[model samples]
Target: MAAVPPALGSWGAGQEYDKQPAFQRLLTAADWRPAVKVAVAPTLVLLAAALIAAIPSDYQYEYRFQSAGFGERFGSAVSMALNALGAPFRLGYQSPLGHDRTDRLEIALRVLPMTVTVLWCLALWLGLRAGLRRRKAVVGQLTRGQAAAEALRTALVLAAVSGLLGLLGGTEWNPSGRAAKPDYFGDFGSGAQKSGQPLITAGSGWLEAVAWTAVLAGLLAFLVHGTDALRWAAWRSRAVRGWAVSALAAGQALAVTVGLSSVTAFVLVAATSESGAQTGISLAFLPNLGLNLLGFGSGATFRAHSGLSGSDGSRGDSSWGDRSSETDFSFFDLHDLTGDWRWAGLLALVSAALLGRVAFRRGLDAADRLRLAAVHAGALTLLMTVSGVLMTRTTSSSGWIGSARMEISQEESGGLAFVSVLVANAVWALAGALLVPPLLAAFRGRGAGAPQGAVPYAESPF
Candidate 1:
């Protein structure tokens, strides 16, 4: 008789699972569990941060416009929270007095609160590290493909949640305006007089929501996997290692600069005698203020534009013009605020010293030093450009006043200021990189003699 067929036991099921395609394997719940585990903590943390940040703004809005009910206020908070994550709102106003002469206004604010972003990134890193640690404990080690797939899955989960929240959060604001009033006395010789009330419409679009979600998802993936990719490249190539080291040094210098700026901002906020609500608002914008200070330190100019125009191709009689006015200031000018130019000098000195320490620790030769300088300068210039682009804000309003149409606008600096900022930061970074390390080394060498308990100068880590 032929041997009986083997039963489909656990081992047989395992064999069947192994025979399936990789994509099919990934479709299993167990395969997706790690992604969910990694995503849960960061998603909760991000939503909490967004809500906390939105509170001050929501309070201010409630105080300013007491007409908004709980629903409207909550929706406003949701909108602000979404905006913090890089989504923009489309706001339009239609005047009630218009047949086809509607006055439309649109405002876009592209700035991100760096404080919230930094916190969210920290949470994400922690979650990813925890998830990886758990996976390694169970599976020994993950291959490059496995690690990449994990990161992609986590990002997709995050994006899906964000998109769903956007959809459910009530993006559009209710149209609000004053009712038309009848002229009882007929003193004005007109019929019912319509107030200059506008039917305001404000909400972010699905396209914008999707676009920002995609961007955020990509960023999450990069944050999760970029270090591993860099490490792999560094291990394979000496040039890559050098570039990575230089980039790290550049990042350290930037951290020092931003830290100094943030400290200054905190001090200023503390000293101000503003109301609690105003102070809360200021606290919410603290990161933006820090970046603006960074821009000021780098010799960047802030431009202001306020203009008024009529609908009939005529300029309004107001003094405001279409031309923008640039306010060029230096780091030293902050002495008026900080009470000393030495504070600015201190920021520079600390950053330079940090870079110097990095160079000395690596035992970089002259050529390596030059490469570090170039990399640092390039990194700083790139950061300045990014900050300028991200921090821009624009607003415009138009309305009719007795047949004389009026329009007004306010905006920040234009593109030329970004170029100027990049150049300034590059120059400063180059000087710091080229000059600081040798100076620090010389200073340290003055007391280079080894004490009885001390290691020899040649063997010293410094």
Candidate 2:
């Protein structure tokens, strides 16, 4: 039997997901279910955050049993648990430890959410980059109006994701004392509350508002620029160059700040505040695990293509023989497999695939389409990984911090929760510093190929 030529616009046919539509892409490529698998990490993170928010403002999950002297026994147990699970995501830049209970918990709880939020933001940036490229392709395939419509859809999704994450970080689930209990004294008493306004307002509210604004702007820009690239060749060309430079620069800065904030905040809070056990998942674990798998798979595929490796052995019995022995391999690099940097590699891969597919459509034997699939898949893997990690961080931290804040707001903990909340905020702020650079670097690859467009495959049902 003659080999089925790889499809260009849809998920690569003649490959594992050849039957799937391009638009149905999700967290895990292998899993087609819509529940949580497709949305994967980010969705999980969001759910986790929601759960954290759902915790009653006055509810406290306390584990206190001072059997061995003062706070020793109780503190040791909590701290131990935190240390163990916290290993994978530990950005670990702490000063000498301290005995401050509020301070320690604050640091531990804050790091995860801040790191997770920053990481998700990075994913949004990458999605924007991909959406930009995809829109450019549509402009070429359809009428200018149609291309614009498709581009708008892409931009909206990316923007929405970014907006949601920002909202997660900026908003506080547990309201404070004055706000939580407005009717201090009810029947037969004057309802003169000391503080009339909510504890969390203005600046915090403004921060979230601005975050939403930026998200919207980013989404709109990506749609306009991407479709524009296809509509007007001259405009598209300039837009591509500008988008590449701007996206890369922004990603680099954002990742760095996020990373640094996470690290520094953790360290400072761990040192000065009461230390709880390092608890919950880090922002680097699951997503990176996925990336590692992607990198290894891509590496194997590359070797196969280069003839440095052999076939799966079962191919020998196929009617087509081994003409596609090389087709089984991929061409993405390992270092370019994770972080924000993977976007650059994705663009390069798409370019090659687009050219190859066009050539193949016009009757040219080529491996470009396979390479492009490998790259795009790799980028998606990278995006999902980062998003997942960030989401995990957000969920884990939000629960801990919110619970703590509840305690403080109730005055049983003497404003300790408020302090912890601040620490968490600090950690989130610094995340952009530490994590963005390495991420941005992952996307930096040669970008000299012609732009590629993605289209739906004929065989896919969804």
Candidate 3:
């Protein structure tokens, strides 16, 4: 019998030329659309989240919880919906079925968006796995340049869709209209109050609507395309490329985690300031905590590069030669600026490989995982840094003025504290966003840079 070629056929019984029904096919448009749909739901949920976020601090609303009794914060919408099936209806009071009605609704509302975010994270993981599997099947046999190009293409598409949607969703640009301005930021509300005019006008409503639409679209695009990029990475490397990609992925995950945590910190500080308490616990912190958990969980892969050991709890050493190993750096140690800068060097190493510059003579397979992680880490780190700087400046500049209660009756003139910082940070973030794509692309190369033998999958894993 003739030996079967792995590259020529599927592991299961199938022919490359065979035609199959839509439902039965793995890589069909119909199949992929579900992922897109799943991806889109979170964007819509986030859009809702942004809207809830935008409600003036003055807006009167009921509080909701995720569980019965009290204290539980965000809950999964799916869980809430199921709970609601048997929940009794109540008016004005809280319902115990989904935790109390108001709290439950709030929890449900928060959870709805979380469900999508979690899914997005999951999808990215699955996509990367698929890329690896595909690449492995064709180890030592591919056009390196073709593979790199494909990865870049996928990343670009994902970025474009995300950006467009973000613009459409309320998030593209924070509303700057007079009514949308916070009382702490300016005297718009107070002036309106003194002038005997409405604080919110119809024109502001139009702007808000436009903003929300852009943000929702951007959210959808971000999740879907980001996952797609990961998937693309899996097959862009054969044995040599795989290891490089993995390393990059690990580094990127680490950086993004840090960046996101910083954002949460600022949000916390702001919320705390508003409550008149310097050191109270916050419900908002949960999301950031969850994000950190997820990042570490995913990044563990790079720390333990031997098989799936990272997930199993065995971390490797932190030395550069032990590139694939994981380490448990003390939290206090990480806080040191010098220590952080040193790790930034490690990040640079991981990123360099993914951009197609091999380190330590590592082959494509060895480099694949790490390099991809690095790319993610690099982009995320950049975003986090940009956002962090802005948040710090904005909060500080606003200072106590941001916290002072400004009713329609008070004299105008607040928000002088950190206006300059906010402006500086915003400029930094915009510059970072603009620079990341080109920088990422530059590493992937113009043509023939993927490393020989990389294979590609026809469909996304998630």
Candidate 4:
């Protein structure tokens, strides 16, 4: 009688939670609309950013001949908008007369799509968290494969929306018409020089848009679902925390890499302006600068033809006049650049993982923290590589010009620059990620910030 009967439910809450099914606990939409909404977020964010950037007061009419007609202005605004989205893709088409700008608006706009992607991820995470917390949805039990399939379904929806929006957006600006094909590789402004053109007219974005949408959605789903499982907490395995640690570290690294690159570029530009190099910096320069900063941060270099003529760069700029066969590299290399910009890249690599180490040490053993850092760094580098692939090509003029042909592009290595960007930065970041955490853990451990059961390096197999 003194001992009394066992209390109602269970000995431990963990068993009760483990008994529940994942599918029954998962979030369910009333219909397909929420999926559709998530899918549409990227394109809508781009459009919204573009629209906001188009506040008439933000721009001043630069060319008198180019009156602020509705189509021209709209096209220019759209060009700026699309270019912002494409900046990471190495799409750096310059206007013919140097009328194209790289302003703060363009710079700000470049990151909007990425920001939207993150927001979508957070939304999915919150939705999942709510579903579990409120026990709102009821369904049959789900296997891991089923859960994965559900995530993929969300990804496909996102891809479909992106593809549709990309196609619809370009209905007006068929590059096939050719006042001059809107150069995907160089200045978008030159294309907009004529009236009635549309921004983002090149027929190249649909595949990319769809592909990116799927990738981003899938990653978002994986990241949200993997870490917050009730079962994971129940297992209490250090390995689970390692996965979570790395995932969080990787996310933080990615954000830091992007942010530092952008900020570094802006600060340097301000320095240049103050120093009177002028660099002929224009408002359009901000986007270009930020783009270049991205490249620089990822251990890539930048060079552009001031004039793509076969002569001593004595001749001037023209889209058709642009030429860069092997015979032309010597001439174009005349304006080839060399800068100390890679220092910024080193900083980016280190900074990306610095916070990751602090985070890793808090919840993970030295080996696990190191492993988590490496994993996170790898994910971060994958993202950086994708960004590099996008920003490494800016080609113009591909028709034969006499015996010589035109393959106007800044990357003399054809397309290897993107590959170079991806490889170099990834190697740098991986090294930093792998090395930094263990070193810091070793230095700071033994009494503080060590994981629950970690031992000193000398005592362990490592």
Question: Relative to the true structure, how large is the alpha-carbon lDDT of every model?
Answer: 0.56, 0.31, 0.32, 0.45
Count clashing residue pairs per candidate.
Answer: 0, 44, 75, 17
Candidate 2 similarity to native, TM-score:
0.27
**Which ranges in model 2 have alpha carbons more than 4 Å from their true place?**
1-44, 52-116, 122-148, 154-247, 277-462
Residue 351 alpha-carbon offset, candidate 2, angstroms: 32
Instruction: List RMSD in Å for every model shown.
Output: 7.6, 25.3, 21.0, 13.3
Candidate 3: tens digits of C-alpha lDDT, residues 1-462:
998753322323554423555444543343233334333443444344333334323222222111121111112112222111111111112222121112111111111123333444455445544544454476532344434443343443333434443333221111122332453536544453333321110111222223433443344333333444444455553543454454554444444544354354445466557563332322223333333332322222111111111111112322122112233332234454554323323332333333333222223332343344344444444322222100000000111322321111111111112233233323333333234334544666643233335354555434
Q: Write the per-residue lDDT of candidate 1 for residues 1-462, one digit (tens) a residue.
A: 999654332323645655666665654457676666666765675567546644443443342223545555455455555554666644555544454445556565555555665665667778777776776688755556766676677767666766765666533443333233334325331221333344445454434655665566556655554556666666666677677777776677677767677777666677774766656556655656665565665565644333332223245455444554555556545646766543544554555566666766666656566677777766655544434322223333334345544455545432225666667666666666667766766787742222112123342122
- In candidate 2, position 347 carries an lDDT of 29
Predicted structure 4, TM vs. truth:
0.54
Per-residue CA lDDT of model 2 for 173-235, tens digit only, reads 212223123253353122222222112110012233234434443444444444444434433
User: Which candidate comes out best when scored by TM-score?
Assistant: 1
lDDT of 4 by residue, 1-462 (tens): 597544332223544534446542332333333454454445555566445544453233332223344443443444344433342221223233222221110111232234334444556556544443332255433335544654677787766765554544422222222444344424544444453332332222456656765776776655444333423442455566566555566666556655665566667767666543343233334433444455555555443322333322223332454555432121123234664543655555556466445554555445655665566545544544333222224333322232222233333321114454556555655555556656666777643354646323342121
Comparing candidate 1 with candidate 3, which one achieves the higher lDDT?
A: 1
Best lDDT among the predictions, by candidate number: 1
Model 3 accuracy (lDDT, Cα): 0.32
**Stretches of candidate 4 above 4 Å error?**
1-31, 40-43, 56-146, 171-204, 225-241, 271-356, 388-445, 448-462
What TM-score, computed on C-alpha atoms, does each candidate reach? 0.71, 0.27, 0.29, 0.54
lDDT of 3 at 72: 12
Runs in model 3 deviating more than 4 A are 1-32, 51-381, 389-462
